[model samples]
Target chain A: MSPVETGRRGAAPDPSFAPEPAGAVPVIVSRDLTVGYKLHRERKRLTALRDISLSVNAGEFVVLVGPSGCGKTTFINAIAGLVQPWEGSIEVNGRPVTGPGPDRAMVFQDYALMPWRTVESNIRMPFELQKLGLSKQEIDARVRRYIDLVDLTGFEKSFPYELSGGMKQRVGIARALVSEPDILLADEPFAAIDAMTREAMQGELERFVAKTGQTVVFITHSIDEAITLGDRVVVISYRPGQIKEVVDVNLPRPRFDYDVKSLPEYSELRDHIWRLVKDEALQTAHGAK
Target chain B: MSTPDLSDGGSISEATDPNRIEDTEWTAGEAWERYGSKVVTVINLTIFFIVWELFARSGAINQLFLPTASNMFLALWDGFTTTAPPGAVISGSIRDHLLYSLTNLSIGLFIACVIGIPAGLLMGGSKYVEKILSPYVWALASLPRIALVPLFILFLGFTVKMQITIIALSAVFPIIINAWAGVKTTDESLLAAARVFGASRAELYVKVVLPFTLPFIISGIQQGIGRGLIGVVIAEIFGGSKGLGYLITRAADTFNSALLYAVLLLLVIVSLTLIQITRSLEAYVAPWRRVDKV
Candidate 1:
């Protein structure tokens, strides 16, 4: 199946395709999360985040948007266990994250696929990580399935460099999804891609997420992308970032199915987010100067 | 940890999977393109030999001192076909000399690889190891390795054993330094990606670090082989050992320009063959590099 048509074909657990209730069990939770880095020069601690708290229900797609260097990345990195919180705790599936775990997968902006490995091997990464006791045939079968899902079946033997930016990120998505992680955290995965490819990927991601119903935490500076894919858009503050507002996107499933920005509600949501972010950006620029 | 397989009974779309893409046109184009380069290379080689032959016959240089190209080939044929004089200590045939020199080269290079690879890996992996070894490596690599010949002659005498030591010592530095550089420069992002995917330290090295370092290590081997060739010639020329280098020395003493030119041609051919072999080996191990140098 083509990537844009992926999640649509899979059977949905809820045929009604309604927005999940707010009281649904949280798949990911962060409590008063704060992170700081030790600036070795003069031995000072530079705090990147301060007392941030948020929770995403199971199967929810949450987008976190802010200006650059606002610790949006820090928050997701903490959620991925790539960065440790100096204060508070972040949990995935009721377990506190100590380090990167198998239950979670992250899609980085750089499309961090191993250059030496082919598309097939990159997809089979999690299978090879810890021996799953599956036979070689079974492993190959699992790999082939995801390759089909990502519409990369024929390009399995191609190296990452051989692929276009959009395709490489598709492999990155396939690699992340192959592990069947409950929580998918992406760090501005589409930011570096060309505008056209970015739009296509956004739609592809929407289909993938809609079908799988996995909880997603996507970080980006694009308000349009935030409204396009997220169930709720979390507007964050400047450095030492805290949540300034969490705006619910009460849009329909498969937002990429139509021109989302053309909707009346979409404009209001976009304007609302821009108003909050514009003030924060102005304050940050003045503060920097 | 095992993930629940997602496609157990899921419907698979029948689409144009590129894995089954026919290679009919691509294979033909690739082969044609490759052969085009090979033809150019052959033409280039022919032009070089033709110029050299014309220069020789033009009397631009004395034929008695500098043999003509045809004369050199004649001497080479004689060296291969003819046997040594009555009661000689070793065979005088060029084939024997070539084989003898190759034995010393192989043994010396093998020893250098055995010691250099581990030392370089440790140096690259640990700062402590690097700190302790860096001084010695810098000094040894900088030192004129041929100068060690006199000291070696005094202690070990003019034997194959001493020659092997010379070749090994000459080759060791490049192998170690190159391996260290290769390991040190392994892509940082790839390492991070591997770690974030739940690879242990050992797994990270095996899966990511080692494959990334192979090309560097091979380049090191290339340099090591070049140095080893120089060491072999130095040992044979100075120590009067039974190799092609020694034969060249005798030819020089007797003013046998044809034999000297012949030996030089043989050396060139052997070095080219070694280089071709290594290039093929490198392309084999790192096919991804063949694509776009990832």
Candidate 2:
């Protein structure tokens, strides 16, 4: 079955589900959040992000775009509770972030699927690691459903090494969605995929999250991808990163089906983000902060 | 303008249909492709033996140093098919010595694994353990295990205990080092993914690190088997009445050149068989790693 048909059927079983009442309630709030890493060898701390404050509403798709070393990944990692903020605060569900919890999950750029695990086992890893209050049958059903949702019904026994780049990322997507986390954090998830498959995957990602109502914080260097997938594109500055601008994308829902790339408004948003990022990108290229 | 219709389910279904595959009769070329290397190896070894047999018959070299291939095979056959007379000091049959050597090697390897696996795991899992144990491990592993044979002989006296100790000591270092490297080099992204998925520290080790290190440990055992074999022969040669090493020494002392050549051939067969078993074990446990070689 096509992903769209599965997504529709999957959403239909739950009548209480509504497309996120975006802008009505903020799920993630960051206030003066400063996060960095300690260089133990140098006895110094490197600030990857500085004094950043942003609020993402429930079910909103926020894309962070910047050059290399721009702390875009640091922001997402902070949300995932993989790293702590050096100053101020970052909160989820109106509570201060402490560490990784069941409410949040992340997709890595490298796919990061366990090489030893089959597709079915990899998607079931979350339940193995934590108590999700799920019965064995429920977990099995959800794993199978998500596998079908990602159109990987027949490849359940295949290992990561047996898969292509796109198929592996589909497994990554399925794994992240299986836990049904409220917030989905992706760090350059499609960076390694080939260009044609990446376009198709971006569309599928939109459809999946739309049906599931996940608040997504996606990181990317591509302005086109930001405009294509994001509700708001956040442009960040180079080393000791700060938010340069947050450009709202007023494009229609299911933008891939709408062929929004041909729209003049889409080009305008893409060009504006490119302009906002150009100086920082150049500075990054020349090794100047 | 005439691109194939990818959206049509007809071609796609047929391509992926498992039943569409049929077994075809093998042609001469196909049969050759499958078994050519094995046939070549048998023929090459047969020619080698024939040449050796001719040279030995020509008497170009001393029979004491180079026995005829037929004489060597005869000795090997007699050693297997018969047993030494009752109360003989040294058994003439190769079977007894081969059995003794193999049993010692197995016990020694088991003891080595028992000590080595935990030591390697502890070093890899804890920074403090690694710092404390690394210097000693490197020092002992770097020293040729042969150098310690005499010391063990002095300490335990030319007994089975001495031979076993030497074998264990020789085998343990490679296992420890390989397990250590495996744990240390586990892919970082896998760890990150596990963490993000709500794995605790202990879970990370159990679910991520241990599985990742298993293939390494197996390969380490493979190396250990080779080293342990060397230790076995050396220890037995130095001071023991029973093993292939002892047989080799006795055969040389009596100038039984055929028996000496037979023992050497037995050693080669034993080593190759053990190595082949480990290789199969490695491939079975970690089929994903085997993909790259093909």
Candidate 3:
């Protein structure tokens, strides 16, 4: 079936779509998360984050926007169970993260698709990791389904090298989705793509979250992107980052392309985020050593 | 635009027919021209042999000491096809000696590879291992391995085992050092990606590290094989009953220059064949190297 038809069915209010209380929980919860790194030859401690508490309700689209090295990546890594928070605890579905787990898939800034693997095989990597006892046919079926979802039907056999920047990110997205993770944490997933392709990807991601009801934590520098894709935008301060402001985007559901940026609410949200981030971005430019 | 000069009489001949002008075409001469270099190589070898034969016949050196190129080939043929002079049997025939030498070379090389790759991986994998082993490996690798022939015979006795031991010892360091360096130099980011994907330690080695280090290891293996062959020949010359090295030694002792030259020719052929095989294998395995067309 077509993606639009599939989206209409998925986003439609179905009784079955409600969270099953037994397994479903808040996708992510972080309490006073502090991440730090040991500084160079001097051996002084450098704290990248301080007492950051945040939680995303299941299916919420959250965006973390800040200047470079604002500890956005460090925060996401904590959530993905790659980085251990020095001070606070992080739980995905009430289980404290120890290390990288299959339940939380990460979309890295560089799109971390294995260079040796083809698009289809890259998407199937999670399945390989799972070592699921399913037959090859079953694996192939799920692979085809997700490949179609990302609008990459025929490009399966092509290697990552053969793809454009945007297509590689789509393959990255497809890889993250194939694992069926409750929380998808992306670190500047679209920032690497060209402007036109980034816009298209942003739109595609919006539709994807709406359809799947999968909680997403996207990190980006683009203010409009933050305002557009996020259900709630979390603005972070410069080095030794802390939560500056958490602005709720109460724009209408099923965000249409024409009405998206043109709305008054979108402008107000954009301006608010800009005010918070502008100083930090300027601080970075002014050679803040 | 006026047709740019496609006009160096480039035999790729779409230009010759107006209707087929836009289509790609292969000229007959071009196909033959591609094979021309191989024919030239054969002609070069022929000329080289002719010069060597003319020089030897002109008695530039003592005739007994320096046989003509044709005489060397004849000596080799006579070693195999003809009976020995009355009451004198050649210590071992050419085929027997060549086989014995080849067997020792092959066995030694196999043992070297078996030990070297894992040792290299371990040294490469940990900083502690590298720190401990780096000096020792470098020291061994830099040693004049040919000088150890007598030492190998003393330790292992004058047997094939002694020759094999010398060969293995000579060859092992290159493979180990290269393998270690190859693994150590693999991209850290790639490993991080694998770790984040929840790859097990074994999977990281087998899938991620091994493939990346393969080219380096292959180079090491080729070097080791060549070194190992030299070591075997040297060891056998010191104390061997039946091998190419023994034949060369016996001939030199008796001043049988023609037989010595013949055996040397055979050794050259064997070594050349081995080098060509390794090179072909390297090209086959690393097709990603842009220079290798096939």
DockQ for all candidate structures vs. native: 0.28, 0.31, 0.09
**Candidate closer to the true structure by TM-score (higher is better), 2 or 3:** 2
Poorly placed runs, candidate 2 (over 4 Å):
A1-23, B1-33
lDDT of 1 by residue, A1-289 (tens): 1111101122223343555554577777788888978888878988888888887878878899887778888888788787888888888888898988777888888988888789999989877785557898888887888887777867898889888777788788888887788889898988888897687677767766766778899999899999888878888899878889888887765565556678898899899999999988987898789
State the lDDT of candidate 2 residue by residue for A1-289, as single tens digits. Answer: 1100000111122232344432357788888899999999999999999988888877778899999998998898899888999998999999999889899999999999998899999999999998999999999998987877676778899888887888888889888988999999999999998887888778768766766678899999888888888888888999889988878887776776678899898888888888889998899989952
User: Which prediction has the highest DockQ against the true structure?
Assistant: 2
Estimated TM-score per prediction?
A: 0.86, 0.91, 0.74
DockQ of 2: 0.31
* Candidate 1: regions farther than 4 A off: A1-16, A36-46, A131-138, A236-244, A275-289, B1-37, B85-92, B292-294
Docking class of 1: acceptable
Between which residue pairs do clashes occur in model 2?
A: none
Question: What is the TM-score of model 3 when looking only at chain B?
Answer: 0.83
lDDT of 2 by residue, B65-88 (tens): 999999999999999998988788
TM-score of 2: 0.91
Q: Which model, 2 or 3, shows the larger DockQ? A: 2
